[model samples]
Target: MPEETPLHERILDTTEQVLRRYGPEKTNVVDVARALGMSHGNIYRHFPNKKALLDAVSARWMHCFTESLSTIASDSKVAPAIRLRRWFDTLRETKRKKIQDDPEFFQMYHTIAKELHDVVTAHVAELLQQLETIIRDGIKAGDFHAKPGASSAAMAFLQTTFAFHHPALLVTRVPSDDEADTVFDLLLSGMIAGPVSKKLRPKVKKS
Candidate 1:
């Protein structure tokens, strides 16, 4: 016989289905319990409230989304520049695919994200840490120049590419792959260190 799924996992799985059907606003513990054939009190035992349940679901989704990128970020075998570019490309494509394949889940995620600021904030922080790792490696390899620190450079990279991966912007319009590549190239050019043509160098104003 196959091992049974844990009650906690079942609750989260059922809660995701409920959110997909009714969205975050209408979803509640009772809905999840009804779907799972359990009492709402049982759900409270696993998750304190609806917000906590939503947070867990959102965190799980984010973990799935970030897992691949994490692998790319830590891949020392590849050049940092190449890995960085691949990271952003993967991030953009993942978000696009998620939206295309399951729009209801995507919209539900957006609604939950708005209500659960802490969960969103934690997710962003995790992404930044991954980016920072890649950037610090790049600096060590002399592929990039970040004078301040890897953390700040990582922030810059994320903020610059927000249009491609951010849920709100993606919901409004998904940029073409070519457009995302162009932006990544532009951002990379600024960070990469080495001999550069005069035109590519930033001109400084005389004091």
Candidate 2:
């Protein structure tokens, strides 16, 4: 026999449908309850109120991105450099797809994220920690050097590539994929643990 769906799961599913149809600003417990064919109090039993429900929805959305990145981070088969590159590319693609696929929902969550400061902060810290783990592994493998702290390097890499990851650039002045790869290589080449090629080598003036 098929297992019954949890009430919270049902509530979340119905809430998403309501949110997508009417937007988070206009969505309410009554609407979600009506969609689920239940009383609004039923939703409250699972969630304190609308904000808590919305936060749970936003968190569920954030995890979809993190879960993929976590797999890349924990995979020992791939080289750190490759993992790093894939992580950056995947993040860019995820944001781009979200904006392109359901622009209204994306905008609604974008606004919600700003209000969900703790959730957003925790999510960013986790992403940065994953990046730091990759960088730390690279340093241990002699693939990277931590002249300036590996943690700092990871932070720098994330910030340098912020344009591709930040929601602010989700719809505006985004760089082409080629441009992003070029920038990644340029920054990454400096961090790698070996001699730079003449082409990548910075010029030094003879005194």
Candidate 1 per-residue C-alpha lDDT over 131-178 given as tens digits, one digit per residue, 9 for 90 to 100 = 999999999988898757798999998999999999988888899888
- Candidate 2 lDDT by residue in tens digits, 138-202: 88899997566678887888889988878766756567899897999987897885445679879
User: CA lDDT of each candidate?
Assistant: 0.86, 0.83
RMSD of each: 4.3, 5.6
- What lDDT score goes with residue 100 in model 2? 82
Which candidate number has the best TM-score? Answer: 1
User: Can you tell me which runs of candidate 2 are displaced by over 4 Å?
Assistant: 1-5, 193-207
- Which segments of model 1 are wrong by more than 4 Å? 1-5, 194-207
lDDT for residue 96 in candidate 1, whole number 0-100: 90
* List of clashing residue pairs for candidate 2: none
User: Candidate 2 has what TM-score?
Assistant: 0.86
